[model samples]
Target chain A: MKTCYNCNRLNKDNDRYCRYCGKAIRNNSYYTGLKIGIVLGTLGIIIMLILYAIMYL
Target chain B: MKCIKCGAELEDVDNFCPECGELTAKGHRFFHDPSNLDILNNGKAVKLKKKFNAIISIFSLSVIIFALLMIFTGQNLMTPFGVIQKKINYYRYGYNTSLIKTNNKYNFKVNNYDEAIEFIKKDFSNQLYTCNQNKELTMLEYELESDYEIPSVVFCDMSLEEAHKIKDVIVRMYALFPNIKGNLTNITITNSKTGSDYVAYFQPAYQFVNVNKDIKENNKVNKTQILLNSYYFLNDNILSQDINEVLNNYYVEDATFESTIAHELGHYISFVAFLREKGVSNITLVTKDNEEEIKSLINEFENGEYLKNILEQALNNYNLKYNENLNLQSFAETISKYAGVKDKNGNLLYSETIAEAIHDYYLHNENAKKSSYEIVMVLKSKLKEVF
Candidate 1:
């Protein structure tokens, strides 16, 4: 079951809002943006490395 | 609970307050001294509280359930936990030691990597550690890291063009471990400048406690340092053929090179484990740490001649009692002598007998644990005569 948004109460997992006091149930998007930035950086570095190796060889 | 912005006890107001306004932390305005909420809330907020309670309960329950699965499956589930749990993750194995799991086939106790690597180096320096030789490890050190990578043995003695068939055989066995890579390279260096033709090396050492295979009739090919300094089978076409033929004479066609490697590797690895299990130390240099004369005396026992005598006697004195399948007269003068049996009549009996017994014990016995004291003292003393 999902939790209600208003109070820290039990609600069905499918429910969008909290069971006690209505609150958004989506886990805090604390690192989603950070993770995406990291992914982009890693891809860029890898591409650069590939180009550098190709040029040297 | 009063609204801090309005200085008013929480009453009919917006999420802020009528007197003054301040944003409230989520659900903080609803806080009250605990009385009977779940029961009252059920009709009141009962269904909502139950639903939310179920969610929180499931999260905690999931953690418990996953922990149970990790325990039963012997798989490390720490990495899969949440951020806080992942930071503090630990696994336990091998005498209550906490271990960290790695995505490598070379899984072992945390403390063993150092011991494993040190032992491998000692094997390299002394040349005493071979896959098949049944030698007592005087001292050992190990460096145990979860490096599942199979090592590459460089063979400077011959190139793949020269040793194609042997290369195929070695690499095929290596392919068994997912991480093992690289083809054999020959790097045999006689002097600093003159490298031998048949040499290769493997990396990220792993331990092989023992490779038990039949040695009689099959020439036992013991390899040292299967972990690193990759194994190289020198191409002596004539000698290889001779070794093959000798092997054929002793056994059936089923006993092929494939079966032989496992057994030869077993001997070296068992000794490696033996030394580590006993916590042996000071293995950097191969030469004796004590008197050179004393070292010589001890070395003779290692040759395995004397213990052969005592065991041969044990079997001879009691063979008729042990088994009734053998012909009596044929037993007295047989090839048992070459198979580590002593020359005396009783010596062959027990020596061959013990080889069979110990071999069986090693292969089938539920507990293959050793008594180092028995090996170092009782067994060593008995072999003093042979040395």
Candidate 2:
């Protein structure tokens, strides 16, 4: 289990960011969602293309 | 639209100018070096100005002079030729405008780059920092894509390393700076380059360790160890890889990738200060290789006058700050993007944003880390809670 260094708030160890405090649990300087957007968007496009190809072909 | 050299501005003509005898490519400045010619300004005007631009061409073309000089002169004439040109520029403008190439002096003059960083980190801690992503701060809040937490500030002192299944990558160059909680620093970092040690310093002590692009391409082993003084090697394959990439993104200029090595180093500076608060002195944290020496230093600080007070103050301050995390979340969100990212495993990525911010100040300004107190106040309010 992870705990807030400041408040002693118990948190899940696997959780990257905190739930109650919202601070980072392991790495504090992670980018929020810049590339996350690109990665997820790319995956979505690829999936949609595959589905479209299957339906049409 | 017509080629003069071939007279084919497209009319079945060859080797002849449509209107003038000048070769098509020869008449066009685009085909030639656009050195001192204000191409942008000239682009707006359809008609080209002067046939030969004297000033900028001299400035730009002379670079080739010394290179050719060495090849022909068959000696290290490039150095003397550079000196002569610099003197000419000085004589002409009463100032030297020639860029200094490869100055490794700052590393020696500033005393390991951390002192400049400490100046800001310590001051940032002394201020009443506020979390900025509040009600009016809605925009800054959106900037926070994500963040991970370090269990303790101790991770602040690890060596940044990115290890894949096959290889471990070490950054040849990195920066360090202080991250404040607010956006109101007294120190003003800028784009102007001025200073003696290197790139340019906004102030005396602070400087940005601009990415070192000096990679020797030969098999000649030129190695410089990034002493275990960094926090990149804490965990092995146990951290977030996303954080590592984000750190690299920070190196991207003006792309909304905010990062600075100093900001991450700021955390370490604060950690060092925190250690100092515990009455730790001369207790340098070295890598395992230097374990013996550092261990001796730590032993020296076993119990000092300020140790307990340091713990109390920091513990209390941390708790006070965490209580405000939710409200601080918005603030953390704004500055989070600018921060030098790290992975859950303690791998440092790219540059730390605050480090770069201050580095910009250090490189371009005269005051450098001079007014770190104000900078601390501004940064503290914006990032006191992020870590």
Candidate 3:
């Protein structure tokens, strides 16, 4: 079972919304997107440094 | 779930409290967690993080720009580092003010040639003012009646006795060349201790001395004075012996210390004659007209054979090799033979041929070589007519 944060009512675990008040459930996709962005930015900086060294030195 | 406003307990299915009709769902415990509240309200921490990132970005960009500039230009543009290096160089080789203060006790500055002459006269007039007081003193002054005259002086950095000897030689030289008396106002006598050779040269008063001011609006001429090195006169025993031996090979007899002064005076006289013939005051103004005059004069010299023979003989006697293909048809070539040929791009020096000719004419007279004597006679006649 899962608890509805808005209505204070118990619902089925697989339900996407609260049964009593009809509030939509939130997911972890936003946090996952933010982690991917951080990783790609770091890689881009490292690539720029390598290119700079090759061209100049 | 519980509603804090009414302190009422409710079932999970209920939206509001039973006792006070308060909304129990609005006050959820998950949303009221301390950690979540901290993240939502920390504006200062977020602002600080943004400022730190901006600083890092700017610093990295500047470093990259600096590196690129250095790679492209190959010059050290580091301002602070360059300033430090300049300071080090200045400390190492800059002028020594303390030495000047200790040795140069008779230092004086004058505005013009007249003022410099007055200053020198006044200094000499004083009975107490001896050369012993100052071994190295300079009298700085400017030339008179020119549009452009810089502060020039006759420096004497020698012992009292040596300076006096050079002064006497200068007076004698002035007496010989009355025509150059005005230009010979400034005289410098330097000693051997200065690590310089026994060199005597004339520094012209003006780069362009305009003798014919009425003819041209901006006529220029070369007006010069002699500078004598005191070393040859001061240490005559050792230096004169060496010079005399070298001069003896040319069949030149009795070459005294005074002969050197006369030789320099010869250069001055030749320079004056050159200016008069050209009809222009300044050497810098030597144009096709002057070249033509020089060529005609060279032609008039028995078809250049006389000069060619003399030059060839001199070179052979001295063991100095010259250009075999030298064309005496060219005025520059004729002058170069007498003056000693230099590299192609070098300024054609004041003709040493004419100077030596004049020197020989003045000293040897009837005994002087026929070629040199003739050349001097022609130049002197021309100069007398012009002046």
lDDT of each: 0.32, 0.30, 0.43
For each candidate, report its DockQ versus the true two-chain complex.
Answer: 0.03, 0.01, 0.02
What candidate 2 gets wrong by more than 4 Å, as runs, is A1-57, B1-291, B295-334, B344-387
lDDT of 3 by residue, B106-178 (tens): 3233333355445433432332121222323322112211211211233323434544444444445444433
Over B132-188, each residue of candidate 1 has an lDDT whose tens digit, in order, gives: 121121111110111222222222223334334434434443342222222111112
Model 3 misplaced regions, further than 4 Å = A1-57, B1-130, B133-180, B191-196, B206-223, B240-242, B246-253, B274-350
Could you tell me every candidate's TM-score relative to the true structure?
Answer: 0.25, 0.20, 0.36
Which of the predicted structures, 1 or 3, would earn the higher DockQ when compared with the native?
1
Question: Candidate 2 has what TM-score?
Answer: 0.20
Q: If both were scored by lDDT, which would come out higher, candidate 2 or candidate 3? A: 3
User: How well does candidate 3 match the true structure, expressed as C-alpha RMSD?
Assistant: 20.8
TM-score of chain B in each prediction: 0.27, 0.22, 0.39
True contacts kept of 1: 0.00
* Interface RMSD, prediction 1: 15.7
Name the TM-score of chain A in model 3: 0.50
